[model samples]
Target: MNERHEHLGRLLTDAATRLGPGPPWLVLGTVPLDRPTAGSDAVAGGDELRRWVRRHVDVWPAPIGIAAEPPELHPDRTVFTPPGRPAGTYYCELHATGSALGAVQVGTLKESPSDGGEVWAIGEGALAWLTIALLRLLTSYAAHATGWGGAGVEARIIPAAGEGPVVPMEVWNHDGGAYGRAGVRRLATAGTARRTVDLASCLSPALTATARPLVLDLLRRFGLSESRHIDPAGVLRRSHFTGHDELIRTWADTIGVPSAP
Candidate 1:
């Protein structure tokens, strides 16, 4: 898979984990939403898309970043700002692929702004759940498409340029083939058990070690820990980062810098 596909997979996985398991929280294949029609120059034809997004989405109403269609959803381009954001703001991607509609993506837009606007901060709580949701959704889609089930998944926090450690997450492939390698039919089927464990360990340290705790804490606070599952309604109703102190510490520690612990 190219960088676009990899990022697409990443985005979907983020949505699935963060959104959690429930009604209206469906895992979908990669598709396009803006500039319906197919071609290599999908990203170029995003004027209409920008207008549409501004009309619908409440956050980031202004166009700060460029929008292009992902290569996977050729023909339908997306209008979005690059990733990164400020404390009070968020950005998302909207697209339709095949039969899928209104695939909303938040926070993958808003990279370092050229205009020098406020950048949003992705706290630990959001990062943790977002990582899992993305993995779960991507794994499900990959499994369904490849006809091979996923064994496990993982994630981590990595430093971004001029930013503190971010949740640079990845998922393990139970299959033996390297990720996105050409001529690999079933990505989840080519691996041996030894490789599987190693891959899982490498891919999911963030998920197991940190994200799980963050999620557990959030669920506990909402009196939903016993549910042992994500509540989409609750999340959608008021979606913002919950934990602050621990998140800041995680970012600091992950980056090997000293912050109030």
Candidate 2:
């Protein structure tokens, strides 16, 4: 494996050892805010990704909220980690405002041991987990409407705190608010990679197969999808997070919970 990948693997293994057998807990990673955005593209470790998935799954029942605060530093607004712990864990929290738009928070990526600031560690996993949770929750709550015609979904990955290499994804349903909606979505997925969702699956079940093409065409106009040729009969095919139920369940095993809490 490459050095970056190898490093992430080792960190996750250590985290497993620290947590012991049974269920897994969230892991956070720190990144420098000043780091180049390009560096954020690095692939996260497999173990880290696994743990991250577990964390998000745990929050499935609760209203999924995405935040940028330090899990250890921000306890009340955060869920994954406790406060004043000084651990470099990912930040996970609910976007409780009820409004779909806000400034998604980000955590610090680089910390010096001498500085005693929280550095990246278990937090990275937490960030990743939170990313997916937000997506699922957004879809769950989205209003299913007709007559909009051709609304598409948009997703992107962004880095935070420098350590990023995290994903910043969004699902833009249609125009009149595509950018605005995307901004809110990014805020939801900030600090993790898996949060990017395939918007096609989140469509209202009431939509007929005949209308699927129109929705996709509209989505393309908003810059969310690549083509107007999307098939309504293939909505499931466009979903990026589907068919991974088993994988999600396995990941939860590492986090100590059977599934997202």
For each candidate, the alpha-carbon lDDT, in order, equals 0.29, 0.29
TM-scores of all candidate predictions against the true structure = 0.25, 0.25
Q: What digit string (tens of lDDT, one per residue) describes model 1 on residues 135-231?
A: 3333322332223322222232221223333322112111233221111121111111100111122133332332243344332332323212223
Residue 207, model 1: lDDT of 25
Backbone clashes per model, in order?
35, 42
Candidate 2: 10-residue stretch with minimal lDDT: 95-104
* lDDT tens digits, residue span 126-230, model 2: 223333334333332222111112212222222232332442323322233221232222232212211122233433332223233333332333244432122
In model 2, which runs have C-alpha deviations exceeding 4 angstroms?
1-90, 100-133, 139-156, 160-234, 238-261
Q: Find the 10 residues in a row with the least total lDDT in model 1.
A: 186-195
